[model samples]
Target: MKKIKCLGLVWLLASGLTGFAKDYPVSSAKELSALSLKPGDRVLMKAGEWKDQQLKFKGNGVKGRPIVLMAANAGKTVLNGNSTLDIDGSWLVVDGLSFANGRLDSGEVVNFSEKSFSCRLTNTSVIDYNSSDDKVDYTWVSLRGTHNRVDHCLLKGKNHQGVTMVVWLSEKPNYHQIDHNYFGPRPELGRNGGETIRIGTSTWSFHDSFTLVEENIFEHCDGEIEAVSVKSGRNIVRNNLFYECKATLTLRHGNHSEVIGNYFIGNGKPGTGGVRIIGEDHNVRDNYFQDLTGTGNSAAISVMAGLPNPILVSHWQVKNARITDNLILNCKEPFAIAAGYRKDRYLPALNTYFAKNIILSNVSPLKVYDEKVVVNFEDNLIFSTAFSGEKGRGFELRNEQLKKGSSGLFLRPGQADFKPFWESEQIGPGWFLDINKKFTIN
Candidate 1:
């Protein structure tokens, strides 16, 4: 076994870095963490391999200048947490490091406290080794902080899920941003793998809000994105790319959020689709779905009322939501939007808009499972489904046989603008889609 070396303090002090009160160079993660860190102190890990250790920080930093913890050189340093990194501080930054292959008895590798704010982890790579059972063996990064950003990183693993970033606002933590990352190719088999980014309301708090997930690449994971039971005021997920995954995105039991400007490709397995919506009001617009080919089952987009009866169907319901300005290409079945609460429960669709989208080269353009549900539809383009069983390019619901409403499947001129409806009011085009086509409203 190669022994790791601890660089001297003189080397770190002479490293010529400013904006800090003092600097500390650490050889081992345990030795580095044992020191008492203050508000303006900086800790630099020298170039070496660290193994089977947990690096923890329990310090405080002020608002203006944060305590900096980073690798000395870009690719020269490695933090091989054969265990994990538990962070319990505010305004700390970790950059330019590598986190690889660790055992997870607790199901988590990196855990953050709610009080940690404005922290950032960037330019890092997290790779996991294949286990005997072919699982990733741990959850990559577990979050519970506000205004924290994780960007420009590569996270790849097997068996367990990828990054499970959660917010516990009751503990005074909110506003997490996860952007510009790559996630894929878990070591495990079967579809038991979870999502790349799983955003859910923490059990500690009901006030989770203001989470932004964008510009990430998700490929070959069982489920790409899963947002479950988040009771927040504003959540934004946009401008992402999904390829060769089981499911693209699923939003369940959430209120007042926007899912737009995303690209979904090659998904559909049994109970999955490109985008699935259940619960409250949300804006699903300006997205692109293409080549969703698989054996199990898939749709471009599926919106259904939550489970009913004793389950207490989401009180707000799927109301005041807009689904427009999207393009669905080469799908097995394009749209599956249905109403009527699950299992004999009836729910009405109020102020819901499904308009100005383009569906091309699909077996059936639109498949409305239920008819009693009232949906406002207008100005959509459905190309070349005139000869198969339906006539005259219009919306087809409930297995291409039943048609409902006046604004059925038909080709229209341009897309609809859904920016005004978003909570954050910050809208942009998808990852690689044409921006000129996005701003032009029909």
Candidate 2:
């Protein structure tokens, strides 16, 4: 009786009584759309170029059992030439696909719909997928909904205008995670709307995005001044590498965001900026800014002055900013206080605190635009080749010789043990091994 019962259970599982997951091999978009996918089901695309295909993958799966859409062979399936993907479901995963040699005439290349929750897009590549006309604006990736993630992807060569990736927010908080990706080589668009990543728009700036952007690399992404524009509240940008990118990660709107542990390596490039502050209660800490040449409003650290009684869409006064424990090495302008101050825009930063920072620069460390700006500095250190009895209210000058590390980074004595948090192997796809070959940390 026991042997007969065990055999009966096996037969029931095999005969689909237990709802076993299955894999469907699909060749065309029409074939893929015909199937109704369930949880733990996988739709595998054939390993070839799928051109001019508009794929809308819509399914609902519970937690721990996601519906997956992937290539039969990883990195071998390409969607090119007017191809786009719309993920409009919950707990879905899209992995190992490539979008190259293509341009979307309208809409985004990859869009997570407004109702897509707990969805993820991983190990994908969107390369050179731009419209031929630069004026025709279309985004590459549009992330919406809550708890969505875009990770381990390579997004590069976006020459046309529009954000490379955007996190669209609704009335509620969208907790998105954008990490471990490579954003590379977007040339100057010479206008606005060229940000590599924008969290929220001006209309949704007051909403709480709760987004986290970390462990990514921004290489030569000089589309506009703002590389990663934070326009929402309570977001975090941490542990990312900005490699020779001629732009600043601007907190353009919203409040109470944080920028932490990021490395900005300019390599003495022109117009290379670090971070720009324009909000309230934002914290910028534990970041390293090296070899940047941008000055004035594009300094390594800039705090913008606001307009009197500014509108919601305009610049707001930076209040209660905490800039702490940052390393500014060989930068042209280390700090720009009251950066955009003018006659019309005369409201300076208020109650800001700069504490425990290390500044090693050739020029003056601080550029105070207005005398009414209330900034408190405490326990900062300045390393200089010639001290000459330099003294300040909050800084101590030390004549120290800097030495270069094995990876061509100049460090002060006892600071040689500082290692980068994010590495090339930790970010991007495994097949793209040359992610950070140009900049290697010791």
Candidate 3:
């Protein structure tokens, strides 16, 4: 092992030139700790397994010249940190590594505590295979820092929860991005098993804001993808795939967030809904819901603004939200929304926009409560039928008046010509069945 103090500065300059790449091979974890890395310095970890070691780097890098710690080869390299990676520095990049078997009595495997600026962890795999206990080992990756990015990582474990990525306003870790990660298959026999990704403000009165989760895949999570309760705002979730999750996504109490371009499949367990929006000024659009079958209770989407019973007057105002351009198929029940104010306190009305969607194989397509709740619906296609002696139609809206027209019904191409029997409905597009395309959605 070669020890080089402040060698990061030299490597920083050499990183701009091709000659410096050969000299900066970080062969051991011990040498990685000794170097005072700066911006543009690239530390390459050789291909081998290094177990039960704690590697720490306490240095800062510039914006354009981030200090990078990546794999020397595209081969298998493991870091079995029996503790955690406490990232306390800024502007660092850790890429292309596999971290496993992190044994912490408590806390997260990767702890980003009280750091600022930005860090990127890409193309990494974190696996926890501890089957000895039935307790959740806190979070796999805890984000208490600002503007960090975790991308293209596979996080699998037998813990209570998968990821607790959060931000607090006072110690506010704002502008964080968690994208293209896979969170799934929590330990089957664990207690207190809950959300895959839990988002909330810090305990010390911190406000979280500007978080983005996109293009991720989540499966077999016992709880929802998100649990937000604080005054965080501007959170965006788009283009992700959810399967076998209890609740795909939920917004307890937040404002100005958006969920768009997502695929939700097989959510809602025995008695629940799929996507629950319980906040203010939220937007849900361009989503696809399919095959949500459980114990006789399922809704493609549910929105509830206010609190129920003992009713705090201001709790239920899920106001000024929009739901549009969605496709709901094979759902056990229709979609629903609820809004009301408490009698004790005076609250304002709730308004919504539901438009341009295709709903198939359900008893009802739209359902709402309270006459004062204004919901606008247009350009939606509804397909309903009764095979078991039940009266089913193309449209059903409960407790609310819906405006329907010819533009509202957008039948599929084959549906316009061929009416199949009740048992022969097509589940997906015809292009998926074509073998010559060389690609499929399955």
Candidate 4:
């Protein structure tokens, strides 16, 4: 009897798996629409062209078992000619698809609806997907849900008015993670408003999205001033490479965020900027900025002054910033304290700390216009630059020289080797354990 009960339990488990886990091979939009999708459903697209098909995927799967929608083959299935998908539910995964040679006629290419949660789009590519109208604005992917992820996707040739992707934060924190994606070749829009990724808009900029953008390559993003204009608070931009882009990663609107471990290789380009810092309590550390030629407002690191406490909606005052452990090399105007400041009675940057930073290359490192501004500069090493004779009210200036004719990459004394190179300080973030890497691209 016990042996029969064991065999009966095995049959029941097999019956349960067959009852719930189903693979639906869809060809037409009507066929996909006709199905009543439940949890643990796998909707697989056949290997063919899906043109002009605006399909909407809707299902609410639980946490451990997500509803999946993938192509039959990884890069074989193509979505062309104004083809798009609207994800409307939670815990859904769309993967292994490609959108090529398409022009969206009206709306977004992929839109996560406002009610969705924990959905993901992974291992996909969208190439040359634009709008039919140049004047009309449309986002490639507009993420409106919380805890959604877009990872390992290749997005290229966005030559339109709006952003490539956006994490729109409304009532709660989105907590989205955009990792290991390739943002390639966004040519210069003749006008403005061509950001690659915008976290939030102006009215919702004060909210905390807490988004994490990591290990992505932003190449030739020549749209406007901000390649990734971070407008929301508590967002993290880390371990990304900005290669020869005409814009910088700007913390334009939010506060209490951090930009760390990013590599900015300008390759002697004229307008390639590194990091533009605005707002308050931002931690800019452990990054490498080199070979840039951007000046003035487009410097390697620009610290904007604040508007006087006025009666309007304006930019925030730069306060309580901790800028440390950076290696700035061979860039024109690497550090600017009161960047883009005029003489017309503005609020100064206050309570900012600049320490443990090493600046090499020519002179003219710091650019401070306001004399009454509050900044603390200490323990920073300089090769051929000068910014501080006095840092604070009674503080002493401590800009240590690298001893002219010193050699190697700051490893040996007066033994210079090749061009600028840095062995950065190793820091283990609490997110990762026991992994020792200097600016490790996460």
What TM-score does each of the candidates earn? 0.75, 0.93, 0.73, 0.84
Cα RMSD to native, each candidate? 10.6, 3.4, 9.4, 6.8
* Higher-ranked by lDDT: 2 or 4: 2
lDDT string for model 2 (1-442, tens) is 9999999999865443455789999988888899898888899999999999989898886677789999989899999989899999999999999999898777899999999999999999999998889988999999998999999999999999789999998999999999999898999999998999999998888889999999998999899999999999999999999998899999999999999989899988899999999989999998989989888778999999898887778889899999999989988889998988899988889899999998887778888888788788888898865333337778888777667765566664577544454533467876666775658433
Full ranking by lDDT: 2, 4, 1, 3
Each model's lDDT = 0.60, 0.88, 0.58, 0.77
Which scores greater on TM-score, model 3 or model 4? Answer: 4
Clashes of each: 14, 0, 9, 7
Which residue pairs clash within candidate 3?
136-160, 168-172, 168-202, 169-206, 169-207, 170-206, 305-316, 306-315, 306-316
Q: Please identify model 3 stretches exceeding 4 Å from their true place.
A: 1-30, 129-131, 161-164, 167-173, 187-193, 202-208, 223-231, 267-273, 294-298, 308-316, 339-349, 367-374, 386-442
lDDT of 1 by residue, 170-268 (tens): 444368888777665542344434556666642322344678888776666654334223445467888876655665476555567788888776634
- Model 2, residue pairs in steric clash: none
- Winning model by TM-score: 2
lDDT of 4 at 391: 44
Candidate 4 has its poorest 10 consecutive residues by lDDT at 426-435
Encode model 4's per-residue lDDT on 393-426: one tens digit a residue: 3333334554322212232234455332223222
Model 4 regions more than 4 Å off: 1-19, 309-313, 343-345, 385-442
> Between the candidate structures 1 and 2, which one is better when assessed by lDDT?
2
Better of 1 and 3 by TM-score: 1
lDDT of 1 at 37: 77
